[model samples]
Each structure stands twice: as structure tokens, then as C-alpha cells.
Target: MQPYSHARLRHSWLPLRPCPRLLPKESSNTSDAFDTLIESFAFPEKFDFVDIDLGRIRRAARAPQARQLTLHLAIRDAPAESPAAQALSDLDAASFKLFCTPVVNLFQRDATSIQLTSTDRAYPVTPEPLETGTPLDVYSIDAVRLGDRTQSEHEKGASSSTAAPRTAVLPYRALSHGRQPDPTVAYWTAFRDPYAAAGNARAPILLSLIGLDGGSAQVRHPQIDVDVTATNGDLPSRLPIGAPDSDLVHEGAALACPIRLLTQPTLPCSHARGHGALWRVVAGLSLHPFDLTQTGLKAFKDFLRLHAPRTNIVAQRSIDAIVGLDHQPAMKWMSLDGQFPSFVRGIEIVVSLEESALRDVTLHLFARTLDRFFAPYAPTNSYVQLIIRSSQAGQELHRCPARSGTRPVI
Candidate 1:
């Protein structure tokens, strides 16, 4: 994983959209504490960027009792070894985007700072905000680069301009802060099937609770019969659900299909609202179910049926043998930097074998490759027709005119 960082912007980063957050009940003590925390910590300069949406600020008002707030900002397709490396990665030069979300009350505070029990790391929290400061902690970061096939066109008349960034001030209310019995037990048990295991299963799927209440927490690994739960000392009754992980996949035949992994976090008591981001991941295995094999077979069948309908050897033993041995093309995800969304990364296709294995190498391969190639100048309303021929005496190759709706031959 390579560390990547966003370039420091001189302005804020929030777009002019309606922020969706609820405000907390106001109290003099809570306001004083929050204001003091904001001022003392100087959070804006400390964080690479901040979101100051009014709704987020209002939501934080509910966390008056919260001593500290833990933030996890997720940047897609950007992975780094450390914060310093992440800061040096040329995120500005790459085609990518930075999406930041807030996580509330993930730490316990001693007297002067916030602490994490699991990692045994403490972060300093002051009563005043710093004008220019360093980040106290670096949470987890994961990124995926999208690909673009049309490089020549992509380079033609390219523009390197961008809009200014923005920041938002979110008031993350103290949600539930206790531990509960691992409710993921049932989910984990379902992952234990031998058939599912044979399918390259994703085990121990997690479903965590997240919301405005400080609630009990739990961990259940049903596949192995393990359960662990914990709770906060002071406000045990009013806590919310646990934090959730990404969805568990039953890898196998599903890998050959176009599928998306969606993570739905634990909901609030209201059943309508919650405090978590739904992370979407593109899932595929390299050389497992052979999605490309399936695609190639389909395309070969099309060529045989549509282009060569009179051929009687389509189902012969040799055809089957070739199909059995043929390898699928390779596909990869890439980034041109800030171009397409997560769903639209650049796609690359590679051809390895010679077209001679089938019929005519040059003509067929050219036609297929051209049809598959990504280009800005792709014909909008035209089609390509290919033909192959073999000659023993001719020393030169030449294209011969063919009648309308007929394949061309040399």
C-alpha cells in the first residue's frame, strides 16, 4: 500500500449542498467544553482539511458528554506506508479524489488527551485550536485507482485545472460508547458451509452498530464459536450499535459476475438514521473463476454463429479443446487522477496469443482489437468487416473489394 496525501488547499473543500445532520440539545457547560476543545485543539490546521457544514456542527452538540472524538477520513485508491509517505505521494498529479467522513467517540480520554485502548496510542487534545499544527493521529486509508483506455485522446487538449477545496466543521455527537455481545455470530455461522468455503468465501462478516447513543459493544466469531462484548461505565443504557465492517462475500461463481460490495452500518434506535459511511468496493479474483474465459467463449461463439454461420465444426472436439485451453484477457483498474468515479475506473485489456491459432492472425486480431480498443475517435455510426486468406505463390498481400454486406478477403 502506497501512502497518498491531498495537496494542502488555501480554501475550504465542501460543496454548496445541503448538509444532512441533526443538532444536539444545547447546554451552557457542553457549549463551553466544546468551544474550549475547538479553540485549544486548533483542529482545522491540524487536519489536512475540515468540513464546516452547519448540520455537522449541530450534530456534534449531542456529544456534550463525549470527552473526545475520533475521526477516520477514507481516501479511495490511495494506500501508503506512513503519514509522511502519504503526504509526499503526488495525489495532485494522479486522477483521484479525497472523501472525508467523521467517526465519533472512538477513544477514551484520560486527563489531558484522548487514548485508544486497542492500539495503546494517545493523541493530544487542547482547549484551543492551532493555527498551523500537525495531525495527532493517522487512521486507516485505502484507495483504488481507476483506468482510462483512451490515452492518445485523453492526452489531446488535456486540461489541468481544478476548483478550490472547502472545509466543514462537524459536531459529532457522542454516540453509544459501550461494548455488546458480538451479534455477527449468526452471520459468521452462515459463512462456515463447505460448499461456500469451496467458493472462496469471505468469513466472519461483521455488522456493527453506530449512532448518537453510547451503547454496548460486542464481537462474535460464530465460525469458531467466539463471543466478546463490552460496555461503558457511566452511560451504559443509552449506547448505540457497534461499528460495521465491509460486507462479507461468498466468493466463487459470484466472482465471474459483475457484483458490488456495499457496507450498511448499524442503524440508530429510530431505525431510519445512523452514523456510518457505506463503503463500496469492486471485488474480483485474479485467475480464479476466469471471468475472461467466459467472455472469450461468448465472443468466439458470436464470431462463429454470426460471421461464419455455415461452419459445421463449431462444436467439434478441436474447438472444445481450444476453448478449454484458451486464456482470457487481463483487466486492471487505473487512475488518471480525479477523472471518473469509483464505478468508472479506467479499464485495460491485454491480448497475449497470436490470431494465427484461430484463422488469419492479422485481419481477425486487428478487427477484434480495434473493436475492443477504447478511443475518443471511435466511429459513432460505422462498422468494421474483416476477411482472411492464404496464398502460396503471391509474394504480396493486398485487400480485395467485397460486395455490400460481405466479409472482405485478401
Candidate 2:
């Protein structure tokens, strides 16, 4: 007792009340009542909703060694003398099945099917001491890789130089195999921090319950309640280095910013919508670091002054022209000896609509157009943007960026 100087733990006991028995309707027969009773008894209230603790999610996002996150299945203890409690007494944890489908970026192509597992076991493990609620059943998820383990220094450098920070939503749902009804599911979204230092303190990966899908009649579709604050909370008030009005000496900005084009048009004659389709188009030129040298820079300026304006190319035509520019010997060698060849990049053209829905053929035509547009530039690592916009206010709803290497199915 003297050796154990810390305070002792205390326990309290509470009295139990009688649990109500299952009562069948007066009009029901004995067989129907028995079946109802059996169904109710078999599926007890012990298995509740599943959740991942915030701390676990934070660790998964920031920890250098964390490869996956753990999900906990809440299990409650039923009254000792109840029939439901007795039914679960000898339950085989392996019989309960749960599956997770990661719905990423609202694009079906990136979705992944992952089967959840318990601690060194499959899902739905029984907690110790069936009569009293204590430990929770655990499931591990390895959907997205985190930290330096998954990326090399060169890969990280390349990604930071060429790409923006990517974000995605991961919605989860349980699959029913006819033995039991599906359980309600929920999920959160996560994005990698592009500016964070490697293997040092950075922003914690935040995960909040963004949506929930249940079997209730009132809830027709999955309701989404995202917390956007988590992602934008720590953003600096000042603009970034290459911002439009900034005076920073960024070489990439000087080369790319001057040639940008932005236009908005309402196309009332489009086949996709009889009323009108609103479009926002933005096009720009990009030069690699090697093109920033004095001689390479001169050639770029010469091409812009002499060749670019003569082409009479708008954003749409420029995108097509850039794809076929390889065939033009004069343009391809604008830079002496082709030491620093220039190609078009950063093209964004979006067509929005306010309508019931586009016909199947209309969507098919768009897909085919994308396929043809990117075909010639496939080897050059070009990509096309396909956006789905909201009908109410012509706002962007979701964007699907299809790379030239892979064709997208509408």
C-alpha cells in the first residue's frame, strides 16, 4: 500500500429495472408471433453505430509511422435476463460482415473497395465480458497512404512543382448479403498538405462526419454535412507568391501569367440544353524551368510576339493547336536546337448548364470529343477537364480531370 502512492479507483453499482417483453399484435397467429420474436431476439441492440475517434484520425494523418487508421464498432450490453442478451451470449463475431467503399473526389474511377478487419481478426469481434460493456470491436482501414514512407524525395519535389494539393471524400457503407439488413454508414474527407515540411510538425489531418446514410424512410438520400472550416482555418491572409497582383520575382509566373485568357459566354444553341449553356473558359501558356534561361527565354518571347498572335487561336482552338504542334517543324524548334521546347498547358474550359438533364447521346458526344482531343497529346502527359455544374446558380458541382493516358466512361 505504501509503495502504491497514487489514488485508488472507486466503483459504483446501480439497480436494474425489468425489461419489457416482446408483445405480438392481437390479430397475429402463433407462428407469426414466433417468427417476429425470433427475428427481434436474433438481432439485438448490442451492435450499435461505428465510429473513428478524432485522435486516431489525426495520428493517421500526421504520424510518420502511421500507415492506417482504426475504426471502432460500438457494442452495448443488454439486460442480463433478457432473451436478446441470451441470444448474443454465444454469437460468433465472424458472422457479422462490414465493407467500406471509398467514394473519392465524386469521381467513380478512383473508388476503392476495402474489406475491414478487427485487431488481428475480421470485423465484428465480440467485446470481453458479454454481460458488461467494456472494450469496443476494432476495424482497420488503409485507404490512403500518409507521411514520407509512401513518397520519395524526388517524387515529392516533382509533385510540389507541378501539381496543386489534391482533396477527396471517402464515403463508407456496409453491404448486405441477404442475411441481415445494411447498417448505417458515415465518412469524412481528407487532403494532403502540399506546403507542410517533411516529417515535422504540421497541420493535423482533420476528419469529421460529413454524411450519414441510413434505412429510415425520412432519409431518402445520404445527407451531406461537411465542415469546410477545418481545411481553411489556418490559411494565411496574404496572397501566395505567384498571385496576380503580387510583385514577387517568380520566373514561372512571369512566363505564364501574361498570356492568360478568360472568357464567359452563354451558348443558347447547344444541343445539351435547349434553353442555354453557360461556359467559362481560361487558357494560359506554361514553360519548364529549362526554358527560363536567357537564350530559351528569348525564343519564347519571339514565338509569343511573332507566331502566337498570327494563329488567331482562342482558348478552344489553342488547346487543339497545341496538341498538333509537334508536326510543325518551325514552331517545334522555336527555341534554338530544340534545347528547351515549349508546349501548351494550364488550359481550363468549362461548360455549365441549367436544365433537367442532358440526353445520353449528348453526354456520349462530349466523351468522344474528349477522347479525340486528347489522343494526339496522350504521350505528352496532357489532361482534359470535364465538369458537372449545378443547375440552380450555374456553380461548379464536381470536376472530373481525365488524363490523356486513360479514357473516361460517361
Candidate 3:
């Protein structure tokens, strides 16, 4: 309703110059070469990371030789403190240094993994071309990370057993926007069942920092609001808030995004911004992950489709605006074969498309299919209703247990 200058910073996957390289012809062990290159880089002494996000590698099997090294660098943007003021401060732009220790969590054990931190920051970043020759040899040392899991009791339990406490770190791959929550959920999904056996189904207890991107550094701000003048509710507040090894907050607040919050549960997703009517439509499907009803069915199918993107009947361009998913998974269950996803418990859409399952699918197969005809990547999209029976607005939905018990799913 209102267009406010939401606080935001200029973030970019800096493409450094003089990229370091080792010709395959020059070395037999590219792994060793990778180690040597990532162990440390002569980054510009002036520009250091306010924060950094290790992103996924854009690996093109077609062109394996030249892999794009993508990394996120946070600019020093503080409220009231203009770029000119930051230049005058002690840690000014002219002579910046990155503190690599606590900002990232890289859980990899290979050539691709390099020891990084405030004191032992590594990665040979250069502006100019450092290596010559294609068919080059490059070794990925480890998985890159961006969020800090040290605070997450569950994530801590999962990581602490094998490695030392890790800070948030993104992988050395190029990413335009930060990692969304779905990927983060998928990230946690990789852990052994016991880790999440206790409290994994609920929203993850992660210290999501990047979610607070735009807004004053002194005080946190919300991304979207029904009316800021009347209710200054921030959508990002739904994310867990705390100060554990962070430069922002009480000084440099978090920089969060609205889109990233959609992946989490409706509690934070809706309460954070105080937009229940709005998010209920977007996040209603999230309620289905562990259940099997209404929007949940669509969510199940969406998760399945996420695993195999090719089989999705809904056009990629139209998914976010997907109309309410059919309460019943198409009983025919044509494409899925017999297998179902394991992350969620219950009937695998729990209504598994058996003849009985068709009972559910038949309800909205045609309408769900018709939803695809509407608008696109732009805003002002159509709304998909939830299958839940709650006729009242701004109310929470409840359902029965999604599955019988925890059984090993292949």
C-alpha cells in the first residue's frame, strides 16, 4: 500500500580480477593446486568483507575448465553513517580487511575447503587473469556455507560431533541473491534422522542474519507492511533474533529479505511482518510438509517436483503464484512412479494416489491445472486458496498427524 525506501545495501557476487589458476598441463595434482590457491588470496588491502556468503559453484559440465568462483561481499552500510563517513571511520573503505573467522560455516574436507577466518582468511582472489589455458584442473575442497549453525542446538549437534565449531560461510560459487530458506531447509534435511528426530519438523533454529538487509543499522526494520504508519511491523522479525558473533545488531542490525522468510513456517513468516492474510496464501502450503491436506498436498507435490524439476507440470514461471493445490494428490500419480520423498512423514502426500487417493485428487485437478493461466515473475499475482476449512480470516489451521510413524524411506 505504501512505498517506503526500505533500508537495503548494495550486495554483489564480486568477480575479482586476476583469477588465480593452475593449468592442467602445469600440474599433475589439481587438488594440490586448488589447496594452494584457496589457502590465501591477496585480496585488495582496501576492501574487506563486512560479511561474506560462500555460494554454489556454477559448474557447467560442458565447460569444466573455467568455473566461475562466486562469493558474496557485504558493503559497509550503516544508518546515518554515509559512505563518506564510513570512509572516515577507522575501518574505512581505503584500508579494509575481512575478518574470516566467525562469519561463515564451511563444512567440507577436501581441496575445495580452505581454512578461513578473521585471522586465517584464505582464498587467492585477484582482479586480473591468473591462469592461462583451458581444460584446466580445478578441485572443489568442500561444501560452502553462509549461515552460522553454532547457535542452532540441532545443527550444532550435527556438526560438532565431527568438526570444530563453524561460523557461517557460503561456498565459493557465484550467487546473485542470498540462499533462500528452502535451500537451507534442504541443507538441514541432509543430516541424519536422529539429529532432527526430536525437533526438526518445526522451523529450524538458525541465526538467519542476511534476512535483515535493508533498514537502519541502529534499529531493525520490516520488509513489507500493510501500513507502516499504523503498524511498523517487520516481516523479518519472524526469524530468530539474537547477537552471537555478529557485526550488526545493537550496532549493525541484520539485513534480511522478505522472500527468504517464505521458506520458514507461518509463525515467523506471518507474525514477523504481521501480514497473515497475505502470507497465509503464500505459506499455507508449508503447513502441508508434515501433514496431508488442503495446501499440504500441493506442498508435498511441490517438494517432489523440486527433486525432479523436469516432471513438474506447473510452469516454473508460474509456481509462486500457483493457485491452491488440489487437496487430493492426483490419484493417478502418473509421473511419480511408486517412490515418494522422505523428508516429510505421513502417507507421502499421505493421500498416496491409490484408488482411494484419487478421491482427494479428483476434487481440484482441473482448477489447480487452470491456475497456470495467470500472471508472471512480476508483482500483482493471483492468490491460491488453502484447502483448510477455516472460514475465518487471520486464523491458524489445524490437522491430524500426517504419518503413522517414522519408517526408513528409501
Candidate 4:
């Protein structure tokens, strides 16, 4: 056995900031006010860099009666020579159109009372080709304004003496190139009512940018040998890779390779509204290396009947008549009520491969059963211990622990 090779590539979220010229001058009062405003918006740290426009804050601080102000935002860290920067430059040269929309959250005001609107303007902006990046001068925010309730009542044919606070529209601006904008970038308008006294207003806005394609990115690594053993002393064999999306490779033994495992970050669609928006973006990776032949399937059924005798008769009949193994590989054993049966508690898995091959094997033992006997338990620590042994001499080769929510290569 020899030492293994490893490589890692990481992509960071683009930093967000106010337009350079509009940044407020250095002052404690202005900076404090600006920081408070930036915190209220609650932009996702992984997607956009959120901060307050100091120039707007300074102007507001100096003139308390000023009714309106606009804060412009742009990407802060894209180098001119980067791949994403080049992609944006190409998009700009081609005059591609980008669309903008507003996502708002009101904390203290009624939803119907305040009207938050954004211009339907489309701008010519695009994300970097291989990574995530937003260009400068892409989005703007408008200041909050207060309207007279009495003027509203007169228009509605009602008489009222009190002049209560009426409709308030948050300020936001959109910049466009001459050509029509693409529907990629969607802006969200977030602001606290400037009319309200300082420290009393709070609002959070979320901005989502789409249209970045990750299908071009594919990861290829050395192949690793895998064997599936069942309780009846029967081993599942590898089938020919016929499916278009199959990741199995054959080199004397069945090898599993992850080709489309890594992907670029993508924002969820607009329908996933409200506080839970971030959780909707999920990435999953799974690989099934071997399949059960007709003989192996019968052996698995017999093993199931002998072990789980109390299993429902209907479930047993369904298992006996199971088909489709010829075309699709089986990944899980039997799952009853979304849980592995008690009989599948202490199954052992032996990996007998060289260190070079071990580097490519990411054993993801999920909560479901595997190979009709092995069901990795989901303990409190969220880790499953895996022991690798040498097949020739039956000696301990390695000890690896698989952790949940992360990829651990064995």
C-alpha cells in the first residue's frame, strides 16, 4: 500500500458593499446608524455582502427632516482577470438583459398599510461563468416615505379629521444597459420606515440571483473497488453500466466513481418565500455500485423471512414479487415506517482495497438499510465507525469513521 493523493477546491461568496462614491464619511453617529440599517436587512452571508450606505446615513443624520434617500449596492471583490469577471464582461458586451424584483419583510407595520414596490426595469447584468459574482451598479434601494391618511380617506369617499400615516413605498433603483436585461438578477427592497424615530424601525430584505449553469462542471477521480455481501453468504455482482447517469466503472472489479458529485451554488425559486428560504436549497450525492441478480434476490428474500418473521405478510409478498432489478440497482434493504427494523443492528462491512483506491471511496451510510442486513445507526454524535480489513490475511487495514452532513473519504 502507498500514500494517497488529495485535492480540494473551494468557492467563496462574493462580498457586497455600497457604491464607492456614495459611502458615508467617517463619523461615529453616521456609522452606528448605517450599521443598524444593514443588520435589519439580514442578507444571506453566503450569497451577498450586506452593509449600509454611509453617505446616505451621513446625509440623513445631518438633516433629520429629509424624507427620502437611495442606497446603491454592487459587487466588491471581483478581480478584472478572474473567470467570473470575464464572463460578466462578455455578457455586458453582448447586451444581455437581466430582470430585477423586490422581496420585502415588514416587522412593525401592517402588510396592507405599507406598499413596497420596485421598478419593472431589466438591466444587462450576469453572473460569472464558473463561480458566483454580481457586478457593480446592479441594484439600488429607495428611502421610506410617509403619506397623509386624510388625503387617502377623501379619495375613498369617507370623511375623517385625523391625518394618520398612509401608504409608504420603500425606495429602490434599477440601472439598465441599452439592450433588454436578462431575467437572472432579482433585487429585493429592504428598509425601515425613515419617518419613524431612530431605533424603532426594523426590516429585512432578501435578494436572489439565478441563471448560473453548473452542468458543465464535472469531477473525475481515481476509481475504488466495492463489494456488497448479504447475510445468506451471497455477494451481489456488478451489472453493465447502461443508464446515461450511471457512475459505475469496471476495471477487473466493480469501481464506483463520482462524476457529478460537486456542483455550484444555486438559489431556490421564488415560491420558497419567508424565513425558510435558505433551507430549500439542498444538495445530495448517492452511489449504488452493485445489484442483486435473480439468485441473489431469492437469497435476500429468504434471509429477510428468516430474520424478520414478524414482518407483515403483505410486505413479504411484495418483497417476493419485487422486479426491476435488471434495469435499476437496488440501494436499500427494507424500510418499515421510515425506520430500519431492529434485526438490522450489528452488520459488519469489510473494505479490502489499497490506500490509493481508499482515497476515492466516500462511504455514506445513511439511516436506511443496506444489502438486506447492514443499517448504520444514527447515534447522537452522528458518526458511524467503519473498519477496513485486508482480504488476503484478514488483517486490520484501517479504521475510518463516517460523519453525517459531511463527505468522509475512506
Candidate 5:
């Protein structure tokens, strides 16, 4: 129902660039070469600002007059501050030098209210006693989180493991609009899995930093604190919240995309700009490896089909079976001759007539032929191939094979 601004900083400080080779003949793959060039030009994490010079590009235009250009800017966390904290801050444009670590488990002990206390004497501190050992100096909010019920057939089938609960993180950031930034973070909120979907899904957590951004730094405000009281009603549905490393083997795999570096021109407002950049980094890394593996599997399947026909049929059946198609007729055709391959699992036969004869005589002979000539060797995987040369001709030469595997005696 509501659009959420992401709090995380995506790695977009990298942008795509063109390859040096002008012709396809000069490079292995132009697209890949271009991707490399993009990576080469990727910006370091430290620079988050970009300036637009419209005057420089408008040389041909009569209005070469200089105009102030509006640029969309992204700011990285200050070196003294951690990116994780920037994600959690409430100020629109506050700068912190401390590194913020991501908190995976936000559900600790529930607090009835939160108190903000300054770590430094220069900053105002709330007098409220925090949960024991809750970091001193930082505004501490004691809040309560509760879970509600889930109803569904799937929930009914869920086992105890499915109902298991875990801690969720609530991420927040501060932004400045027009007034002085609030010194204390506020409006803390988080999302959790409803009891039914508890173990199976991830939970979203969102917290609002009350009024930390606006205006100039000269307008100092008192340190604000929140007293989060618990409620008996249902936990709310909406809260927004927001990788591991693999040692690469030979540059590993990469997804083709443009990347841009982010810079934090202003401290408190960095998240408002940096979130999109952080998302790009994460998306590229996640899909690259999966794409590589899928390509390999498809090529292997194609190779099998080119080398062996028998194996190809068997493998095709196996693949079809995986998609839930079974009991279809097998594709093996055989003539009256006994020649057949070992791979075939079944056979069929068709009988035909040769020359003209009396109707009753033909009927009787056909029955006798099947009983006396062919029925005896039914256990063997062999069958008669009856060929009818001409219907109007008189009785033609009749031939039958013997049980010793010799040519049919005429």
C-alpha cells in the first residue's frame, strides 16, 4: 500500500563503459569486453557526489548562458560512521563517523518505553535507564514486539519447526527536509513473520527516525527519546526493513550491468541518496553465478543428443518423466525380419495378404497360419512380416521360416 525507500546502500558506484576494441575481430566478445571496461571505471566507495555542467554541453545552443543544474546526488557513510548505522538513523542529513553494524536479530527484550541518553556530555542525554548494558550515550528505545496468528491450510499443516520464531531487524535512516535536524532517532518500527509463516519466511522490519533531518546544523535541538509501550492488539502488517563472501576462483562469474560509485556529500542525508546504489551491487552478484550454472547444464544436454541416438531416446524419456509425462508409447518400429537392436524394449507387427483366393479359404488359412506357423515361437521376440504383392493374382509362392533360425522354406 505504501512505497518504501530502501535504507540499504546498493553498490552502484560502478558504471558501464565502452570497450577499446572498435571491431569484433579485435576482441573475444565485445559485450564482455565492454563489461570489463565498466568495471575498470567503477568508482570507489568514498566519492558520492556528482556535478552537472549544462553550460559545457550546450556549446551549439544560442543560450550558452550558465544555469544552475540540479543533480541527483548520493552520499556514502562518513569514514568514521558505519554504513549500517546510516541505514538505521532517523536524520535526513546527519553525519556520523561511527560504523553501524547490521543487526539481524532486533527482537531482544521488549521495553515499555525508550529513553535517549547522550554518550558525550556535549549532546543531551535522556535519563531513562536502558535495558542493562544497552549502549550508553546513544538514545536507547525500549520497545515491545508481539506476534499474531495466521490462518491457512498451509499453516494448519505446518509442524513445530515451521512455527519456530527468530529475531528480525528493523532498519531506519534519517533525512533532512527544511528545518534543523532532530538529534535523537525516533519512530521505531519492525515487521515479523506471523506465527503461522514463522519459520518459513523472512520478516520485514521498519523503524522511523523522528525528525532528524531539516535545515542547518546551527539550529541545535534537545536530544529526543521514545517510550515504546506494548499493546495487546494484533501486530501491524507493514513495516519496511532491509552477503557473504566467496573467495573467487579466477575472477569467477559476473553479471553484465552498469555500476556507479556513491559519495556522501552530506552526512545525515546520505541514505536518502545511497539506497539505490547499494541495491545494484547486491543484484549483480546474486544472479551471475546462477546464470553460469544454467548455461553449462544446457550445453551438456545438447552434447548427449549429438553422439548417441539410443541413449538420446532414453535420456529424452527420462527428462520427459521428470516433467510428469509417463505411459506414452515408446518409439521403436520393427519389420517381420528378426533384426532388432538391444536398446529397444518392445515391438509390434502388421499382417497383410498377397494373391486372390476364395473368401472362406483365405479366412481358414489365415487362422491356421497364425496358430501353426507363428504361435509356437511367441516367447522369442520375433514376428512374421506378411507382404501382399497383388490381390488379383493367383495364389503366390508361400514361404515360412523354421525354428532353427534358417531362411523360410518355400
Candidate 6:
């Protein structure tokens, strides 16, 4: 994918993000050592960054690890490609935030320096943290504009160094949601049937539930504190009891739906804005008969070891898709430059998976990070009243929990 880099920053032109990864070309000699930098930067007129006002961002660069990554996002998980172009072509500006995270062992192979080159030729650029005497370990710059290095005496300041720019950090915007539902009782209809493929072997358990006809007043966004209990027949199930990958899901199975109530904020786009961030996830596994939860997680935990990118694990095969829901909104581990515990010391979580029966599979289920980032949008409390007549194109089976204890999932 062509790297797109555009910013209204007066000092720099980089918007750090998690993706646009780079893969090195393989060579015949496996023993050969190499150091490389893969970067993508473009100044497409199609992207209007003026709304973020990144022009004032300054004075926030420190190397906690050999690898330092900074992210500037106006929107969450916006796909990058022609489709994204079409989906978001209408917007002018959008909400924005800045984050800096240090990755451990990004340069374990060899010391390498990364340089970001933006296709935007008209706008010249320069490196920040203008101090020249500091140490810059192996660095993998995410989103940045490569600026002109030309120096003029007129631009020189005290100590023959460029003046440090002021740093600006934005607070998260909170959504207004009531702690309790306006009404505890509500009806829900099938939003869509899972794709036939997911319904079979790939991942068949995904069932959607949007507000039933005229139920918007009761079912709303930021519906936090989701807890619904139900019998096996109450929830949705396309795969038979012995569904494919029985090791992961099976019969006599009781499923607990840990549904994370998500909020899709109306991102501030230019008057005629485009699509909002998309959240898609499938992460449910059946447990051993009579077990009630994802017991397979114990066996799968063998593959749960988290390590650096350029390192090796004990496994002989590459089984990375073990996580789901875009790895729960693309969750990554953080190190805080090695300050906090591993539980909280991975990558900065922009989005995260909610705690559910499937929690063991991915790191995105970190409730702490998830709440902090989306706190503003979370409802004080949330409850769903359901009456499931039938599901997965199946016959009318049962209703929501009558008394209590059965968990309901959406």
C-alpha cells in the first residue's frame, strides 16, 4: 500500500499509526545479515487534515526503547485503500488524537535508521527534537513527512540549534449515556445471519442484533455494563453442537456472551463527511462438555507467548490468526518503555475487545485500557431486555432469561 502522509503540523508532517507494515525481500543466502527501513508516505490532496489542526503539535519525543512509535489518529481503524478513499471521500476534517509508544526489540537483528519520505513535494519538512547531541537508537517511524535538510543562517537560533516546538496533547471526548437503560425491557431482531462460511468451519458463531423496529429509544449506543445470561437454546448458533473445529466449540456447551458495547462517534468530518470507523469481530469458542467456558484456551495458551517481531518462538508453524475481531480493534501490547507490568505494558490500545468467555485468546480484552480510551463514550450503565423467538434462520426456540443468571449476548 502507498504510504499516505499529510499533516497541518507547522513543525513536522507525520501521523503515527499501527499499520502499513513492511516485509523485506528474501534472499538466497539465509545467513546474510541486513538492516532496512520500509516506509510509506503520500500527500494526497484527497485527505483534508485541516480539521485536526495538527499545526500546533510540538515538543513530545523521547526514546523509551530502541523503537519509538507515535500515532496521530482522527479516526479509528479507517481502512487504507481505494475503498477507504471512496467511503471517506466526502469528509474535510475529523477528530484527532496523538500518542507515543515505545516498542521493545524493534531492532534486534541489527541497528537501522528509518527515514519517512512523503510524496507531497510542495511542503518542505524538518526533523523535530532539534537537539543534535541526543541518542537516537534504532527507530521505525510510522507516519511522518521527510522534509528538506537545507539549513540557512537565518533559521539558526541559540546554541546554533532550531527552537523546540511546543507540545499539545488532546483529551478524549466522552459520550453522554445514562447509567441505566431508559426501560429494562426491550425486543431485538436478527440484524443479519452470519456468512455461510462463518456458519460452517471458518467462524460460524457471529450473530448480530440491531434495534428492532421502533426500538431505538430503548436500545442505544454506549450501552455499557452488559450482562445477560441464557440457556444454550437462547443464544444464536449456526454450527451444530459438534460444529467444525470441535476442539474449540462443541456439544453440551454453555456459552457466555461477553458483548462489548461499542460507540461509533460522529467523527467531525468536513460538512459532508464520509463513513465512520468500522468494528468487526468474531471470538467465541465452545468449552469441553460440562465445562461451560472456553476450556480449549488452556491448550491454546501454549501459543500465547508474546514476543518481539524479529524474534523466534517455540512453535514450528506460523499461526497468527489466533486472535479475532481485527484482533479486537487491532490491539497490541505496550511496554511504557518498561515501566508498567506486562499486563498493561504492551502497545497503546486504541480499541479493545470486551471481557467475555473468549477472553483467553487475545490481549485486546484488557478492560482497563479499553475503558480509559472510550470512557467519554461509555454509558454509566446499560441493560438489554430480549425475547429471542428464533435465530440463525432456525425455528422459534426460546425467550430471554425469565428470572436471572442467564447471560445475554448481542
Q: Top model by TM-score, which number?
A: 3
* Residue lDDT tens for model 5, 1-410: 22224333232211111322211232343234223322221211222222334343343233444353232345443222432334435544354322321111112223222222343222222233343443222123343222222222233477867853422212233232327433542233333223423462322222332323421122122222223322211111122212123211222347643222122211110111134644543333321211113343343233222222332233233222111101111223443355644433231222223222221122222322222322222234433322212233323223333221112333
How close to the true structure is residue 162 of candidate 2, measured as C-alpha lDDT?
57
The segments of candidate 3 whose C-alpha lies over 4 angstroms from its true place after superposition are 1-140, 143-290, 310-404, 407-410
How would you encode candidate 6's per-residue C-alpha lDDT over 40-81 as one tens digit per residue? 111111111123332233222323332433445464433353
Q: After superposition, how far is residue 195 of candidate 3 from its true place, in Å?
A: 37
Off by over 4 Å in 2: 1-58, 61-97, 100-343, 346-381, 405-410
lDDT of 2 by residue, 50-97 (tens): 333445444435554554544333445334543345555666766443
> Candidate 3, which ten residues in sequence have the lowest lDDT sum?
223-232
Can you write out model 3's per-residue Cα lDDT over 45-115, one digit (the tens) per residue? 11122333322222212234544442333544322333233444554344533442211111112121222
Off by over 4 Å in 1: 1-291, 294-300, 309-344, 350-370, 373-410
Evaluated at residue 347, the lDDT of candidate 5 is 18
Candidate 2, residue 214: lDDT: 26
lDDT of 4 at 401: 34
RMSD of each: 29.7, 34.1, 26.2, 29.3, 34.0, 29.6
Model 3 whole-model lDDT (C-alpha atoms): 0.26
Per-residue lDDT value at 123 in model 6 = 15
TM-scores for candidates 1 onward, in order = 0.14, 0.16, 0.17, 0.16, 0.14, 0.16
Query: CA lDDT of each candidate?
Result: 0.25, 0.28, 0.26, 0.28, 0.27, 0.23
Model 1's alpha-carbon lDDT is 0.25
lDDT of 1 by residue, 1-410 (tens): 22223433232432111222122223433322223222112222122233544345334445544544443345543235423235546445343324544222122211211122333221222211122341121111011111133322343366544322111111223222235633321111111122322242222222222223323222221111111221121222233333253222234564543322221221111011123211100011111212334465544433322211122242222123223213222222322233342232121222222222333122322223222212211122212222222222212122222111111222
